[model samples]
Each structure stands twice: as C-alpha cells, then as structure tokens.
Target: MSTDSMERTLERTRRRFIRRQRTQRWLRWRAILAVAVALLLVAGAVWTVFFSSLLAVQAVDVEGTSLLSPAQVRSAAAITPGDPLARVDLARIEGRLMALAPVKDVEVTREWPDRILIVVSERVAVAAVPVGSGFKGIDADGVLFRDFAAQPKNLPLIVLPDDIGQDAMKEGADVIAALPTELQARIDHVEVESVDGISLVLDDEKVVVWGSAERSADKARVLDALLNAAPRASTYDVSAPGQPTTSD
Candidate 1:
C-alpha cells in the first residue's frame, strides 16, 4: 500500500477510537448521575416521612365511639400534633385506649400526610348490677364497664351474691344473651347463686330455672316453646332442655 493511503487510514481509525471512548465515558457518567438522583429522591422522601413537619400529625379522628365521646378517645390516644405521622406508635395508642373499661377493641392507624385515626369498639351492656346507690353495666362477656345513675329499663338487673365469682356473673350474662329477643324483653332480672344455679325472673313473677351456661342455647329454645304452649305456667324448668317441664 502507498504511505499516504496508509496514513489516511490510520488517522481515520484513531478518530473512530476517540469517538467510541467519548461515547463510553458519557454512558457511564449518565448511569452514575441517574443513580445519584434516585438516591437523593429516596433520602428526601425519608426525611419528609420521618423528620419533616410537612407530614407531621395535624389532627386525630375518632370513629365507632358511642359510650365514649370523641374527646375521650382523643385524650386516650395522646398523640401530639406536629409529631411525625409515620413515626407515631399505633400499637401504643391502641393499648392506651384498651385501658378504658368500655373499650372492647381499638385500632389506631395513620391517615397519610397529617392525620391519625382511632377506631374503638365499645362494649354493649347486657345487664345491670346493683352497686351501692347506682348500677354497674355488665356486657355479654361479663365485663363490668359503665355505671348508671339508676337501672336502665332496657337492661335486665343481675342479682349476684356478694361473694359471687366472675364465672357466675358470666354465666348469668350468657343465659340472658341466649334468650330470644321477645323473651329477653319480658325478663325483669336474673339471680345468680352459683355457676350452675342461674335463674331468670320474668316481669310477671314467673321463674325460669336455667341450670348452667352449658347447653344454654338448647335451653333457651325449649323455654321459648314452653312459654308459648303453657302461657299460664308460673315456673319453667329447662335445665334438661330435651325434657323440659312447666308448673303453675
């Protein structure tokens, strides 16, 4: 080959190599810049969620509260405004609300940018127990929650012995819960002597011998049928539900 031709070919090859090197260097810098930008975005998001006031708590909303007021729920939650929402302890807030007697279950959650939500499930009273001058409300679970100035007409009175155990109170509550709605409305009070000796006194002075909490559903069904069949009966024995008896 001629020297001039060889020199021209060599110059072209050198220029091509320089261009490729420049392109490769630019591609590597682009990747590095992309990764850096992504890292900066992640760091900024973390700061906003964990430390910045932009995502801090501004309000606490309460839901499913009936026995307790919204103010009571908020006070129990004790979440401070301006605290980072993402950093708020939901489990801790729930624990605090559960400490209240009327609260059966509670769930605390963050409502995004700046709000907290506390949902409470309050206990429903099934019976009222005479306590001093007032009456204490007992739920179906036998948990004593609130107090009434006087016995609520809607709830049946529960007469438990002074030394009655929780089991007896729970048994009485269970018996009342098992009764049909129609029969429950006729109930005046329940006398619980022991776990196995629970009785229901109807509004008309009729007595229902409900032996124990066991097989209460069966007993409730039998008693309902007996009441319909012998409407004039004064006492009903449904301890053995399969063979119930009624006496006037």
Candidate 2:
C-alpha cells in the first residue's frame, strides 16, 4: 500500500474511536441522571407521607360534648400538633378519652390531610345517692360519676345499704328508668334490698313493690293502671303485674 492510503485508513480508525467514546459518555451520563431523578421522586413521596406539613395535623375537631367541655376532651386526647394525620393512632386516642369518668362512648378519626375529629358521648345522671354530707350522681347505667356539694332536685334519691353491690344499684336504676315520665317525676326515691328486690317511694310517701328489673315495663303499666283506678292508695304492689294490689 502507498503511504497516503495508509494515512487515510489510520485517520478513519481514529475518527470511529472518538465517536464511540462520545456515545459511551453520553449513555453513562443519561443513566446517572435517570438514577438521580428516581431518587429525588422517592424522597419527595417519603417526605409527603411522613414529614410534610401539608399532611400533618393542624386542627382537632371535638363534637357531642355536653358535660365535658371541648378543652377537656382535647386535653384527654393529647395529640401533638403537626403530627402526621395518617399516622395518628385513633384507638389510642379513644382509649384515653374513655378514661374520663363521664364519657360513655368516643370516636376518633382522621379528617383528610390536616385534621383529626373526636366525638364523645357523656353519661347523664338519673339519680343521686347520699355520700357523706354531699351526693354522688348515678347514671342510668348505674355509673356513679359525679360528686356534688348539694343534692340535685329533679333526680330521685337512691337508698341502698352501705354494703350494696353495683348489681343492686343497677337494678334500682333500671326500675326508675322503666317508669313513664309522669310517674318518674313523682318518684322521690328508690330502695334496693337485693338485685331481685327493688322499690320506689313517691313524693307523698306512697310505696311500690317493683320487685326485680325484669318485667319492669309490665309492672310499670300495671302500676299506672292501679294508681289511676285508686288515686289515693298508700301502698301499691305490682310485683305480680297480672294480679296487682292497692292498699291504704
């Protein structure tokens, strides 16, 4: 081969090598750029799920509170501000709220990205029992929750022995609750001897033998009929509602 032909062949080989190098460098940079972009996208998703302010709790909404103020319910929940709403433990917050004496039921939930909602149902007092010089309020479910300096006027007084168990107190409360509103308003107090033995005394000192909590609706009906028939009875017995008796 001539020298000029050899030089031209060498020049063609050098150009081909340079082209290959440029292509490899471009591919390597593209791969690195793709990896960096993927890492950035994953990091952004993680921050949104676990650390972003847009997804953090900004407000706590409380509802169904009467006896307990909103502040009291919020204090019981104890959820920290700016915590991730998706990661909030609803069951833990509900358990905390239930620890309050008057709370009957509670529901906790997350409201989208920025809020948590708490709903509470509080127990209501149906009767009052003497505790030393003051009184303790008892709900219809027989939970003695509140202590008052004075006896509340509308609620009936519960009279049970000092050694009386919760079952007997619940029985007496059930008896009072079964009565009609008019009859309930007339009740001055309730007496419990045992779970199966319950009684009611009216405001005028008229006595009723209500027996156990069972068959209460029947007893209430019979007692209402008996009282209406004999308006001035001093004693009413409806333990056997089918054969009720009234006596002076």
What would the per-residue lDDT of candidate 1 be over residues 23-48, giving only the tens digit for each residue? 99999999999999999999999999
How many backbone clashes can be found in candidate 1?
0
Which candidate has the top score in TM-score? 1
TM-score, every prediction: 0.89, 0.78
Sequence-dependent TM-score of model 2: 0.78
Scored against the true structure, residue 3 in model 2 reaches a CA lDDT of: 100
Model 1 ranges off by over 4 Å: 224-235, 246-248
Candidate 2 worst ten-residue window by lDDT: 171-180
lDDT of 2 by residue, 106-214 (tens): 9998898799999888898888999889999888788888888898988888888898888888988888777789988888888889998888999989999988888
Q: How high is the CA lDDT of each candidate model?
A: 0.92, 0.89
Q: Distance (Å) between predicted and true CA of 64, model 2?
A: 2.0
